[model samples]
Target: MFSFIIRRVLLVIPTFLAIAFLTFVAIRLVPGDPVEARTGERGISPERLAHFRHELGLDQPVWKQFLDYLWQIAHGDFGTSISTQTPILTEFTTLFPATLELAICAMLFATILGIPAGVIAATRRGTFVDYTLMGAALTGFSMPIFWWGLLLILFFSVDLGWTPVSGRIDLLYYFEPVTGFMLIDSWLSGQEGAFSSAVSHLILPTIVLGTIPLATIARMTRSAMLEILGEDYVRTARAKGLSPFRVVGIHALRNALIPVVTVIGLQVGALMAGAVLTEYIFSWPGIGSWLIESIQRRDYPVLQGGILLVSGIVIVINILVDLLYGVLNPRIRHAR
Candidate 1:
C-alpha cells in the first residue's frame, strides 16, 4: 500500500506538468490579445502597447516565454495576473475555499439523498417506486445546470421569496473570513442568524450543482446493488433467515459500494465544472466566477494556474479513491 501510494504521488508531478503545459498553450491559441483586453481598441498608443507587451514578456518568442513560465513555476511563482495585477496564488488561496465549501455542500447533499434513493429503487425492482425514482434521476442528469439554477432562483428567490437571490451570505452580516468557508465562518462569528443566512443562500446553488452527481450516484448505486443482490452470497444470506434489511443493507450495500465510490470520486471533477455555471447564475464569489472574469480579461496566469490547480486536485482525489478500494475490499489490497 505504501509503494502504491508513492507511485501515485510520483505520477502526480508529470500529470500536473502535462495539464499546465496544455492549458498554457491552449490559452494562447484562443484569439484574444491580453494587451488589447487591458487597454481599449480606441485609446492606446503604439509605443504604449509595445511597452505593455514587453513588460509582460509577450514580446519574446513563444518558446522563450514558455520556458520562462516553466522556470517561474519551478520557483513556486504562478506569476501575476495581467488584469488584476495580483499574485495568482494569493487570489487562489482567497477564492478557492469558497469553491471548496460549495463543492463539499453539494457532494454531501448528493450522497445523503442519492445512495438511499438508489437502494430503494433497486430493492423495489419492477415496481412504480423504481420507475419513478429512475425517471427523476434521468431528468436530473439530463438537465443543464445554468437553466436549473435560474429556475430555482426564480421559484424560491423571486416568487416565493424563501431564499436570497445570490451571494454566499447576505451582505448585512459582518464576519471575518477565518477559513474562507461561509458556513463555518458564520458559526465562528457568533453573529445571530449568520449561519442560517449562509445556509439559505447555499440551498439553491447546492441543489443546482449537486443534481447531476445525485442522479449519477443513484443510477450507479441501483445498478451495483441489483448485481450484488443476485450473487450467491446474497442468496445464502437470505436463506440463512437474516432479516431482509440486514441482508441487503449490511451485505449487499457494502459489496456494491466499490463502484459507487468510484462514481462518486469521479463526480468531483464534474462538480467543479458544473460549479462554473452554477456560480455564474447565482453570482457566487468563487474560483469559478473568478475564472470566468479572468477569461474575459484575458488573464493568462490565472487561467493557466487555476485550471492546473483544480485539475491537480481532481487527480489527487481520484488517487485517494483508488486507494480506498483496498479498504473497501481486502482482496484488492492482497492482490496488489
Candidate 2:
C-alpha cells in the first residue's frame, strides 16, 4: 500500500507539468494580447509599447519566454496579472480555497444523498421507492447546473424565503479572518451565529451544484449494487444464514463501493469543473469566477494560473481515488 501510494503521489508531478504546459500554450494561442486588450483603442507610442512588451517579457523570443515562465513557475512566481497587476499566485490564494470548499461541500452532499438513496432503491428494486428515486435522479442528472442554480434561486430565494440566493456568507454577520474561509474562521472565532449564517447561505448553492453529481453517484451505486447482489458470493453469504442486512451492508455493499468510489471521484472533478457556473450564479468569489473574468479581460497569466490549479486539483483527486481502490478492494490490489 505504501509503495502504491508513493507511486501515485510521484506520478502527480509530471501529470501536473503536462497540464500546466498545455494550459500555458493554449492561453498563448488565443488571439488577443493582454497588453493590447487592456490598453484599448488609444494606441500607445512605439517606445511606451516596447517598454510594456519588455516589462511583460513579450519582447523576448517565444521559446525564451516559455523557458523564463517555466523558471519563474519553478520559483513559485506565477507572473503578474495584466488586468489586476497582482501576482497570479496571490489572486489564486484568495480565490482557490473558496471554490475548493464549495466543491467539497457539494461533493459531500452528493455522495451522502446519492449513496443512501441508491442503496434503498437497489434494496427495494422494482418498487415505488425505486421508481420515485430513479425519477428524481433522472431529473437531477438531466438538468444543467446553471439552470438548477437559477431554479433554486427562484424557489428558495424569491418564493420560499428559505435561503439566500447568492454569496458565501451573510453580510449581516461579520467574521474575523483567521483562515480566509468565512465558515471556518467564524467557528474558530467562537461565533456560531456567524457560522450558522454562513452555512445557511451555502445551502442553496451547495444543493444546486450537487444535484447532478448526486444523481450520478446514485445511478452508479444502484447499478453496481444490483450487479454485486446477484453475484455468487452474495448468494453464498445468504446461504450461510447471514442476516440480509449483514449480507448486503457488510459484504455486498463493501465490494460494490469500489466502482461507486470511482464514480464519486469523477463527480467530484465534475463539481469542481461545474463551479464556474455555480460561482457565477451565486456571485461567490472563487477561482471559477476569476477564470471567467480573466477570459473576458484576456488576462493570460490569470487564466493559465487558474486552469493549472484546477487541473492539478482534479488530477490529485483522481490519484487519491485510484489509491482508494486498493483500500476498498484488497483483492484487486493483492492480485497476482
Candidate 3:
C-alpha cells in the first residue's frame, strides 16, 4: 500500500506538468491580450503597451516565457494577477477553501441520499419503487444546475424565505475566518446563529451542485448492486438464511461499492466543474467564480495557476480513489 501510494504520488508530477503546460498554451492561444484587456477602449500609447508587455515578460520568446513560468512555479510563485495584482497562489488559497467546502458538502448530500435510493431501487427492481427512484435520478441527472439553482432561489429564498438567496453566510454575523470553511468556522466562533446562517446559505447551492452527482451515484449504485445481487456469493449468503439487512447491507452493498466509489470519486471532479455555475447563480465567492473573473480580465497567470491547482486537486482525489479500491477489495491490492 505504501508503494502504491508512492507510485501514484510520483505519477501526479508529470500529470500536473502536462496540465500546467496545456493551460499555459490554451490561455495564450486565446485572442485577448491581458495588457490590452486591462487598458480597455481608450488604450495606452504604443510605447506604454510595449512597456507593459515587457514588464509582464510577454515580449520574450514563448519558450523563455514558459521556462520562466515553470521556474517561478517551482519556486512556489504563481506570479501576480494581471487584474487584481494579488499573488495568484494567495488568491487561489483564499478562494479554494470555499470551493472545497461546497464540494465536500455537495458530496455528502449526494452520498447520503443517492446510495440508499439506489439500494432500494436495486432490491425492488421492476417494482413501482424502482421506477420512481430511477425516474427521479434521471430527472436529476438531466436537470441544468444553473436553472435548478435559480428555481431553488425562487421557491426557497424568494417565496418561502426558508434559505438565503446567496453568499457564504449572512453579512449580519461577523466572525473572523480561521479555517476558511464557513460552516466549521461558524461553529468554532461560538457566535449566535453563525452555524445556522452558514448552513442556510449553503443549502441551495449544495442541492444544485449535488444533484447531478447524486443522480450519477444512484444510477451507478443501482447498476452495481443489480450485478452484485446476482453473484453466487450473494445467493450463497441468502441460502444461508442471512437476514435481509445483512445480505443486502453487508454482503451486497460492500461488494457493490467499488463502482459506486468510482462514481463518487468522479463526482468530486464534477462538483468542482459544476461549482462555477452554482457559485455564479448563488453569488458564492469560490475558485470557480474567481476563474471566471480571471478569464474575463484575461489574467493569464491566474487562469493557468487556477487550472493547474484545480486539476491537481482532481488528480489527487482520483489517486486517493485508486487507493480506496485496494481497501474496498483486497483482490485489487494483491493484483497490483
TM-score of each: 0.98, 0.91, 0.97
Could you say which candidate leads in TM-score?
1
lDDT of 3 at 312: 83
**What tens-digit string does per-residue lDDT give for candidate 3 at 1-336?**
788789889888888888888888888888878998988899799999999999989999988999999999999888889888899889988999999999999999999999999999999999999999999999999998888888989999999999999899988889788999999999999999999999999988999999999999999999999999999999999999999999999999999999899888888878888998888899999998999888888999999989888988898899888889889988997887
Misplaced by over 4 Å in model 2 are 41-47
Q: How many Å off is the CA of 71 in candidate 1?
A: 1.6
Runs in model 1 with CA error above 4 Å? none
Clashes of each: 0, 0, 0
RMSD in angstroms between candidate 3 and the native structure over all alpha carbons: 1.3
Relative to the unseen true structure, what is the C-alpha lDDT of residue 169 in candidate 3, on a scale of 0 to 100?
A: 95
For candidate 3, the per-residue lDDT at 231 reads 98
- Could you give the candidate ranking by TM-score, starting with the highest? 1, 3, 2
Ranking by lDDT: 1, 3, 2
**lDDT for each of the candidates?**
0.92, 0.84, 0.91
**Count: clashes, candidate 2:** 0
Worst 10 residues of 2 by lDDT: 173-182
